[model samples]
Target: MLSDTSGGTSGFQWHVSGEGPTDNGVGSPQPEEEESASGVSDRRAKVTVIVLCYINLLNYMDRFTVAGVLPDIEQFFSISDGKSGLLQTVFICSYMFLAPLFGYLGDRCNRKSIMCVGIFFWSLVTLASSFIGKEHFWALLLTRGLVGVGEASYSTIAPTIIADLFVKETRTNMLSIFYFAIPVGSGMGYIVGSKVNDVAGDWHWALRVRLQHQTSHSECFFSELNVSLYFPLHFCCSPSFILSTFGFTTVAFVTGSLALWAPAFLFRAGVFTGEKQPCLKVPCDNSDSVIFGIITVVTGILGVASGVQASKKLRTRTSRADPLVCAAGLLLAAPFLYLSIMFAQASTVATYVFIFLGETFLSMNWAVVADMLLYVVIPTRRSTAEAFQIVLSHLLGDAISPYLIGVVSDSIKKSDSYMWEFRSLQMSLLLCSFVAVVGGAFFLATALFIEQDRHLAENYVPSGE
Candidate 1:
């Protein structure tokens, strides 16, 4: 493996290069593991990327699938806004809490084995959740939480694997392609979930349908026996990691709230405008959901690609390019979100247009943030760094956003008027735009530390400095 070690780093640079950074500038060079004597390193890396993307796509799809059929679930279970919100809350609670455990295991264990175990349980549990009777909504929530255990196992580890495979601009391109799945999967969650539920005349089938995708996501083929034997380190305290994760937290909050409630909000807006009627029965109109899904998919592709390209171009001139792009994305997303919220009652078309713009810009943060984390943290601590980032982001971000938004909306709805539902949700959603500005500020602050942090990670020594 060839490396530029002007820093005289101790540990091999795993994320930036080979298994780790060159040791004391005297590490023996090898032919990049010679494909592990199976002709599988580079080809395998590409395959792994494709498989990981597939897994990510369906994972998000399964997540938002519940949101796609949310109204049906509400009517069938006779639940309140609080309970509906709890669906997301419990899942994120489990996911956020369990991430560190997986991060620990991922750094030490065979990555493929961990994901296989997770997918096994995730599949069985999801299949069973789909059959719960209406009176057993708690069982459904329990199952959703269980599902998180499996997702956490994979989500926390996959990116580090990618970081292990590629470096520099190639890693950015791969990440853009990788993160592209998020919106596409989220949109499919809504589209496939709604259409399936409508066709099956039952929301339960959406869960079952997601299983079809899940059964095929177990193609991992990576190991880390020689990667690191040192005990996993705690989260890096670098300002870049902190600020970027905080910035990403806001993105999570906004996206989480929207994923769980946007369709319902749009439906209520139509009822308030008298363009649509209140749900008189099961399987409510899902036109709003389909439209929103299409918008999400389109914006995700555009945002990730554009953000990556913009950062790549700017990086030639400034080392702070990544954080600046992230800052610009969140800052630009705020005003359009505000407009979307304000226009929902007056004109659906206008609201959709604004949402299109806001979400497109918002989408820019995904790939860029992930790429930033890989570069700004050393390879050995990458998994642990990823763990804490997930914890912090979810702890402050999506974990509570959905439930909090629901509670606020419920508190404001003192009347039986359906219009109150729309109005309250609208008011609560304004928080997203405000949070967006705060996130942008965090990213801007990150620019001050990004270059310094990248240098430190590049030359980082695990211990015994």
Candidate 2:
């Protein structure tokens, strides 16, 4: 056999003729070219993952900062508990409604450009929200909803991009790193919102500062470096759907309530007291925010990192690992959630400890569940799947949890008893514990179908490149 060894200076090419076989191997050596291509692919994938993680960070930060400053917002607007909770509900409603549209566009359009526009749109709306006067509460609500529309575009599509860049195991680790931002960002939102409100003397200024920071960061980090690079990278659920959706909904309900109201709940529980004017000598004791922030960041980082490692290890042995991990986390979280609420009226320190443990367990599911979704869905339908989950989860979960808690609080306060004010919040929050158990059960059910769905997805391949 005659073999052509060289085609171009760029790389060696192998050609075979029936004449003979080479002494060394069947194909010509092209180690340098192969290595170069592999290196570039790896570098691009890493850069893309980092950029997406940062954007995810900003998304959660903007979403939860309002919660951090909820008390100030409540006071400024003279709003009831129901109204306060309604703010989050409005945001989620807008987000859920627009998610499917973006998801459809994401699969068909240039995802990077869509994400860029979304980020820019939300940042602009956030900036506009800062200027909303106390009298213009309706305007604030409108801007918040618009911000949701922007976020929906990015959140539904980003994970699909990551899935295409890597195989299953690597994707799990990347997603864990990406989602680690959730708790960290939520915690920072609280700390930043509280500190900014203290320094600036108003919630409006606090929001403005954070929004401006996020805008600058996104433009500088993502728009300039990542948007252009994102175009080149192209690659890469049933009873699992129902159960996972139910689990996610319950988790979202619990998470939304905590993210939006935990700081205020603690304050009302006597862990901290509010100053009439925080800027009046910076008198507001920020110990609550600082402590909660520390717990969230530390535990969240560790929990997610460890969960990824565990899930990856378990997957080597069993295909059901991802959902099982989620189920375990939810199950562990339920007891701690109950403990946290039980201790709320008894001891602040115990309440904080239990809350810390509960958050740690709860955080474990974030990345694992996302990884499960990526593997179960086909490459072309991932965005749609994500959008559907967002709608279902929010519609049944966080969209109403905060408002329901608020309504419960307000109704209890209508009673003649003075203690009902605090007791009502405690009772409302306890619902999260029960919901956590339900979430755990759903995840457990998901485990039964996850292996089959994942195998089917892995075997099926799309025709086009």
Global lDDT of each model? 0.85, 0.75
Best by TM-score: 1
Per-residue CA lDDT of candidate 2, range 147-224, in tens? 998889888888877776666577777888889988898788778877888888777776776665556645423211
Model 1: per-residue Cα lDDT over 68-123, one tens digit each: 98888988998888789999989999999999999887776667788888877888
Q: How accurate is candidate 2 locally (lDDT)?
A: 0.75
lDDT of 2 at 250: 87
Evaluate model 2: give its TM-score.
0.85
Model 1 residue 291 distance off true place after TM-score fit, in angstroms: 0.8
Per-prediction TM-score, please? 0.91, 0.85
Residue 298, model 1: lDDT of: 94
Q: What is residue 134's positional error in candidate 1, in angstroms?
A: 1.0
